[model samples]
Target: MKKDDNAFGVEEAADSPGFLLWQVTSLWQREIRKALEKYDLTHSQFVLLASTMWLMQQGEPVTQILLSAHSKIDPMTTSTVLRTLQTKGLLERKEHTTDTRAKTVALTTTGEKLARQAIKTVEQFDTDFFQALGSKLGDFNKKLRLLLQQ
Candidate 1:
C-alpha cells in the first residue's frame, strides 16, 4: 500500500465503476427531483404511489407488503410513506381482507389523479433524459438489468 494509493486499492475515484455509478445516479435523481417538484412529492413518495396504483390495476386488494415488493422499496419505508400519502388524502390503509395482521392499500380519488398527472411528467422527462443514448438505449438497459442480476 503506497502512501498515495487509496486504501481500497482504486487508483482514482474517477476510474471506479461504483463512484461513476453514484455520480450518474445522483445527477439523474436531481433531474427527477426537479420534475417532481411541481407535484409536491418526494421521489420515494412518488414511487410508492405510482407502484401501488400500477399493482392495483393488475388486480384487487393491494397490500403494503405487496406494494413494497413490487416497487423494490423497503417495507419500513413503504409503510412510512403510505401513512404520509394517507394523511395527504392520496391513499388509505385498511385491514387486509385475508390477512389478519397485514393492511391493504388503495389510492384515493385525488391520489389516482395526481398519480396519473405525475406519471405523464415523469415519462416525458425520462424520454428526454435517455434520448442521448439515441438507438442504443435497449443495450444500455440490458446492461443495467445484467448489473442488477449480479
Candidate 2:
C-alpha cells in the first residue's frame, strides 16, 4: 500500500490562505505576549488598559459600557478585567456623576506609567511587524479595513 503522502509528507500549503493567516496571527500574538509578559499583563488586559488611558486623556468621562464598545470587548470580560486593573492599583471605578447607575473608569498614575511603557513596546512591535510589508502596508491595511467594514 502507498503511504498517505499528504498525511505524512510536508505538502505545499500555498492555497491555504486561512491557515496562513492563522499562522501569522499566532506568531504576532506570541511576540506580543512575550513582550507584555515583562509588564505583568496579558494582551487583553493591555489593550483595555491602554484604550482606557488614551480615552481618559481626551478628558472624556468614559463608562465601562463605552470602554467595552471602544475596545470591542464584551461587558462581562471588561468588568472582570477592570476589576483586576483596580486590584493592581492601575485603574479606579467610581459612580458616574451624571448617570447615577453607571460607573466611570479612570486610569491611576501607576496605570498611566505602565500604559506609556507598554505603548512603546507595542509600537515598536507593530512597526517591526508591519515593516515587512513596506509600502504595501497601506494597501494591506486598506484591504483589511474594507473586509472589517463588512
Candidate 3:
C-alpha cells in the first residue's frame, strides 16, 4: 500500500501542534477584537494602552523603548500606536525630566478609566475562553510559558 500523503503530511492536521496553536490564536484574537469593540479600541491598541498604564502604576515613568520591551511590541510599531493613543487623548508623552532625548508616558484621566474598563472586559474574555481547560489551565499556561522562554 502507498504511504499516506496529504498536503499537511501523513499526520492529521488537527494533530499538528503548530496548526492547532495557529487556529486557537486566531480564534482568541477574534474574540478579543469583539470584546474590545465597545471601547472603540483594537486589540493592539488595548494591549499597548493597558500595558503602559499598568507599568506606570509601578511608580516609574515609562518610555517608548520601555513600553516596547514590556509589551514585546516592535519599537516602530510602538511609536505608531503611541501616536494613535495620544491623538485619542488617552496618553501623553512628555519630555523626561532627566533625559532630554527621551519622553515619559502617562495615562490621562479618561485613559485610566477606559483602561480599567477595558482590562475588565479582556480579563473576562480570557477567563471564559480558557475555562474549558478547567483545572488543567495552569499546566497549559506553564507549557506556553516554557515555549515563550525558548
Candidate 4:
C-alpha cells in the first residue's frame, strides 16, 4: 500500500487507518462522556453495570471473573468497580455456594433500580446520537464489526 506523506513531519494521518479510527473514536467518547455526566457514572462503569445485568438475566451465578470477561475489563479494575458498586448498594458480593474461591455478584434492589435508570439514560443518549444516521446505523454497525474482527 502507498503512504501519504504531505504537510506533517510524521507520516500523513490520511495514510494511517488506525489514526483515523482513533480520532473518530476519541470524538465519540467525548460526546458520550458529556451525556453520561448527569448519571454520575463513567463510560467504563456503565459498560460493566450493563454487562452484569445482561448476564444475570441468563440465571447463572456470575462471578467477578465472569463479569470481567464479559465486559472486557481488567480483573483488578473489575474488582475495584464491583466494590464501589457494592458500597453504593447497587450490587452485593457473597461467597459462592459451590466455589469457595469465588464470590457471586447480584444486583440489590437499589442496584437494580439504578441499573434501570442508567439503562434508560444510555438508551436515550444512543437514540439521540444515532438519529441523524437513521438507516445507515445498520451499515455502520456492520462495518464496525468487520473492523473489529481485523
Q: State each model's CA lDDT, in order.
A: 0.92, 0.90, 0.90, 0.83
Q: List runs of model 1 lying over 4 Å from the truth.
A: 1-12
lDDT of 1 by residue, 1-94 (tens): 6745767667788878989999989999999999999999999999998998998899878998999888888999999999999999999999
Worst 10 residues of 3 by lDDT: 1-10
Candidate 1: C-alpha RMSD after superposition:
2.2
lDDT of 1 at 14: 86
Q: Over the stretch 1-77, how does candidate 3's per-residue lDDT look in tens digits?
A: 34466666656778888989999999999989999999999887898889988899898889998999898889899
lDDT of 4 by residue, 16-127 (tens): 6778779878877898898778767788877877878888999999899999988879999999999988887788999999999998899888777777888898888788
Better model by lDDT, 1 or 4? Answer: 1
Best by TM-score: 3
List the candidate numbers ranked by lDDT, top first: 1, 3, 2, 4
lDDT of model 4, residue 146: 89
Model 2 lDDT-worst window of ten: 1-10
Q: What are the runs in model 4 whose C-alpha is more than 4 Å off?
A: 1-15
Q: Which wins on lDDT, candidate 1 or candidate 3? A: 1
What lDDT score is found at residue 50 in candidate 4? 81
